[model samples]
Target: MPDHLSPDPLHILHEVFGYDQFRGPQQAIIEHVTAGGDALVLMPTGGGKSLCYQIPAIARQRAGYGVSIVVSPLIALMHDQVGALHEAGVEAAFLNSTLSFDEAADVERRLARGQITMLYAAPERLTTPRFLSLLDGLLSRGQLALFAIDEAHCVSQWGHDFRPEYRGLTVLHERYPGVPRIALTATADALTRTDIVERLQLEEAGRFVSSFDRPNIRYAIVEKKDVTTQLLRFIEAEHAGDAGVVYCQSRKRVEELAATLAGAGINALPYHAGLDAKLRQQHQDRFLREEGIVMVATIAFGMGIDKPDVRFVAHVDMPKNIEGYYQETGRAGRDGEPADAWMAYGLQDVVNQARMIDESPAGDEFKQVMRGKLDALLALAEATDCRRVRLLGYFGEHAVPCGNCDNCLHPPELWDGTETARKLLSTIYWIKKQNGIGFGAGHIMDIVRGKKTDKVAQYRHDTLSTFGLCAESSEAQLRGVLRQLIATGALHVDAAAFNTLQLTDGSRAVLKGEVPVRLRASVSAPAARKPRAGRREAKAASPAAATLDAAGLGRFAALKAWRAEVAREHNLPAYVIFHDATLAAIAERAPQSLDDLQGVSGLGVKKLEAYGADVVRVCRGPHG
Candidate 1:
């Protein structure tokens, strides 16, 4: 029945989940929740937030609270989490639409009789009257243990992934007053945090805000030239044959890039809401089960995924806010291995995101808030100091310069682009004034650079005093300057007029020399990226670089093969069976017996009992 055989949380931790000690605030959070205290935990993506709730579910169940109800947002997440819990020998089940009528009935019957230890359901289902009635029955019987809200930021309007359905979750606190509830999230700013607490009525809950820094994931944002070719080089040169995810802005881009990557001999797949539901599921399944599969997707695919081996997350376009970027990039390196968060950004990306916000039929206040968020992201991208510092600082946390980001590796030289920026803006103003209409960025750039192209000749713009005043500036450098000008509100994109440039009141400052415009000297050169980091990182060149001896490598490879077979037989992702780090440790030591495997980090009693002998057999080579 997956019952907890001990009263101690540490004992349960070792025996059930197989970890030696708690990390950061895990021990305190677990103890608080098990003793019937509510908590709001804000941890990074790979920071062991699951253990905070999962361990309490086990401990409270053992202490006679009966069953824990977990509120999850996605079915895929619930399925994978329940599958992993079952592997750890915890009695967990999820009741969603995936179950047939009889299957749901059976699960309900079991729940009514208190046969399940933990139950997972979406917020919509959890708040439904039918489900509440069942919960009432359990409440009357004193069977309800705890209520865990995962991704609690969805309750906030200011959050990146807000959902109106989450506002209905206040019912959990109102209905189950005494039941200890834990709200958990991976990304939440101070504003979103307050919203979550107020909306979920967790004001009295203990707040555990861990450091938001992810040291294992290096950050990089390159100026875009050929985005696909740049992405191809990134994947091939450093992360070839590694599992990655490339995020695009549109469904068509996702489809096209997936095909392009496949043609380049990379195993890639397309996943977006536009595809058929069945096909989307198939693509997601392939991405989960297979190694070295890159998923080209939009924001639709990456909320509650639990895959721990993703090597990189690339963005071909920029998102509207820092919160969204942080959430999407957090998907990589959940195993605490070295990974990357790479993006190809440019002036057009800024324009697209700004245009999206400007054209939306939203309130003025809402648009203002969105622009504020977008400006923060632009600052991070254009940062000359440290990307990590800029990112961590946005969430109201302070961090020193991380020597792992692109800026730290290759310091950018900022040039006084005031003369250049003024020239470009003046050219745009003159042309629009003469023609009583606006032109796109291309015409403006050509005129400022003295291109003497047919259009420039047709407009006779070469005769203007501002034309070719900054002919020495490269197009790339000018684009960087222009992007900064727009980002700083000195320029505006006339989305209603085919995305032509227009001057705002703020532009007058730059033109009158009241503001200075500085930009990176060489913006679009992707060849300048060099690898470096300040922290000691796991060698990501292979599965187990620490075990590079021929025998250890062979043993690790064989263990992985065995794990793949077991995962296929069980119909789960290979990491769900065991993490790569766990298997690598086992291979490095070449455990001689079952007792030798007892203290490995992820090897719980249940896992040892289930797969201990087979792991030993695989370690002893073919004839063992």
Candidate 2:
């Protein structure tokens, strides 16, 4: 057996995972779970959540416990995780619908003979009678180690990616009374966390809540203007020749955007539910195994992606809620490298989202909850304060200015818009009085800008006192102000009225001058052409790349080349071989031998034996 197979969590961490120390609550969670204690872990994505359960499972196995059964929702995630574990010289297998009956039987045989240390299965499969019978046999022989429920937030109906099958997971606890259970989720609010505990029947589990902050990712939200142009500019400026995910609101938009990127010479592919299963799998596989491929997709593309080096996640349209946005953006910078969460939103996004909620067949209570969530996201986008602070605050946490997001980098000046807000509110009220109906932003903006269009003339609203009150402001500026007002609760979009703008009860305060409305100043438009300074400009512009020097960059490039070659040989993602963080550490340290290489983080005994010499040679270079 390998040294990591020792009956010690610390040994497993060092020898199998090649880390010198645990991060955040990893050690405590691991120790608790290994001691037969149930745990509910709410760590952010890329925060080492996997180690909390993986280390414990390995330790339990070494302590004469049976194979750890991990319940996962995604077959791709299981496959990627199992591949990484095998590279670390650990025995792991997955049982999912993707496996043929004979292949699944072989895995079952291995589990029965104590050949596998960890087994991953989809929740639907785990709850089946045949699988339950297998588990019963294992339990009868005392071969069950523990149970781990991943993506535990799926148990909550209110969560972004609720899966009904997750509710049936309590069967594990009921069937195997003594087996410890640990539920893990990358994105969960307080409500979702409670739901996980209740649904998984892990009320007694220890709660390990980490901060929901991804400081490595820079958050940026820009007003949508020529969306394709903006998106192309962002890609060309910062993320050219890098792996990323671009999220769109609809399948048609995803397809269109993917084609646009491809026409611009970007290696982009579209993914959605509309695609054939084989095509989707092939695209996902290429994204994983190849470098610098961008996946243009809707929300369906990112739930189970384990790729860690994605440099950016761009949203061509707004998400319905903050949780969905956070989860999608969390897919980037998983390796602790600098990544970007860039979004382009406009007033239309809000109207479209409101329309979606109102048109849904869900109950009134669910609609209200969803509306509240969408409003919170809108507030975040329109916030003049720190974006990180506002975002974390929504999740019941507090944070100071991160200084990496757009808000912090270029602090928006607060312009008192009390008069502007009053004018807009009076217009909405007056329009209702005249026609007993609300008007969307376009007509309202036209009246405000004194455009005197056909609708304005037909309504004869040119006679209204509030019409053209703010002719000094441009259409874009007025739209920005209105978005902020809506976000601040001074105005609301009446979903039932075709998303017409309406004044809320709180609008009285602003109209009466009792409240001061401070809105973010409009950002100046960019120059027609941006300067081209090559990769150096890209690296220097990113906060995440501040750590690299010229020599380090050379070594990093060499290490990446080696990783790519190895990944090709194994038909695995480059990150699955070794994350960029590990490569950067190797480049910085320039390890000369196997002993020195062991000191680098993420280089376990298995990795050191397999690639230590090649890594050292790459570090030394030809001159050395």
Candidate 3:
């Protein structure tokens, strides 16, 4: 059969978490960690990755004089985590800017006395001399157990949330060679995984990678002519009152979109590192504690926020790479509920995203890799048959048709791409032969369609044998065909070396008519009639209707009314005190007992202890 089981740690998993069995690779991971072997865990969002480290920390702590040190990325996240650990009766403490000097000293005192089981700190704090000295002391006394790195992907320069301090964590090994290190991240690709290992010095660590599929999230990609209008319609219609995040490629766009949504009367907030720390904190707090408040942000927000009930995540601008898009969209529906992952992508979005990499100061290899990832994301966005299938395929996983996603629920008709791909590949080859220098799509299309443009004539490309071969097709059609060819690996873009177009081994089969190539027609094509403006707009809710209940099912009319009245008095956005979800949950689970109230999710100790009675009274009667 398999290796041994029935370890004492397995028993503790059932006893502490109320879970009888491990999901995916939990048993193997726990066994590895409990045995003091370092591990690098790569799992997707909502994949129970935290339990892999948390359970092992507890087990190893109980086994002997051990203390698990957790290095997190966010202060607010550390607070929530340490608080939860305290409620579970785990001796946990965090050192960050939030704590006073005396309080920090108290935690250090506890650590020296072997009174703390787990400690959380930011990477910046973890690398400090004082903290290292303390760790040195702990190591000497044989009280240090293991080092767990959360958000491990942040250590990679190619990752979306790269942090410079993370690269310095190699000292953890140099300082304490005996402490086991477990690095964990919810999303990472092969390239990112390698970077994580190299940067963290986890050369000898075991890797536990779980499946990257998020079946509960429904993915949809819509190509739009007027992106702002489509985004408004989507937010208004699909995720009106439910909590969601809107990602923008630019800080200016983030601000403008947030303002536009607010002008339209939606409770939308802008979040980016450019904003003041206080404002960012305020927006983050509202997003976590309140429900239905949309946060329009750049890549800075939503790293480790534990608010699990985000109903949807929308992308107003295309993300930098697939990993980024995956992590951003994965933030939605984390509570195992129905959630929508929607995006409005266009040709300009693709160009702008590529241009961003082109402008970066990174090496040529890094930029090329980044472009490859971007192209992959674009291909997935342009796929018609099954979005989920294409998404999981990138991470090397198979999936049945996920009925929740847009394409699986509404499969698109595929067109034969043999002639189209051959025509495009011929154009690229003909252009390269005719003019040694590469040209962008517009100029290349002009030459192919016999436009006789000034640039095309200047290069004498009109006389090429393959010129005007696709003159029957419109400019948009030819462009679409070229894009599809590039996306499907029949054509490749070499942006770093010379921005040249080259064909892969797969393109030869297509040229020989040996393989059937198909692609989804543009959703906004003339043949595919545009969705009625009135209907699209009608799908969206009015400003008044955007503030609904947790499920967006309209049970919080009175609660919203009360919030509006209170907000007007305080001149706030009805979410400063309590979120709609919190209120609706309070309304639904009108806990008569203190234990019941404390058990309510999102109702942390501060809220439960401060406003528990008031909330109970409100749920008990009309005036409460």
> Residue 274 of candidate 2: its Cα lDDT?
96
Measured against the true structure, the TM-scores of the candidates, in listed sequence, are 0.95, 0.92, 0.77
**For model 1, how does the per-residue alpha-carbon lDDT over 138-176 read when each residue is reduced to its tens digit?**
999999999999999999988999988999999988988
CA error at residue 330 for candidate 1, angstroms: 1.1
Instruction: TM-score for candidate 3, please give it.
Output: 0.77
- Report the Cα lDDT for residue 119, model 1: 98
* Cα lDDT of model 3 by residue, 407-485, tens digit: 7656666667678667667776777776665667777677667788888778888888777877877765665666666
Which has the greatest TM-score?
A: 1
Residue 47: error of model 3 in Å? 2.4
lDDT of 2 by residue, 149-244 (tens): 888888898899999998888898888989999998888877777778788888888999999999888888888878899899989988898889
Alpha-carbon shift of residue 160 in model 1 (angstroms): 1.5
RMSD to the true structure for each prediction, in A, is 2.4, 3.2, 6.8
Hey, what RMSD does candidate 2 come out at? 3.2
- Say what the RMSD of model 1 is: 2.4
Better of 1 and 2 by lDDT: 1
Give candidate 1 misplaced runs (Cα > 4 Å): 1-4, 432-436, 452-463, 526-545
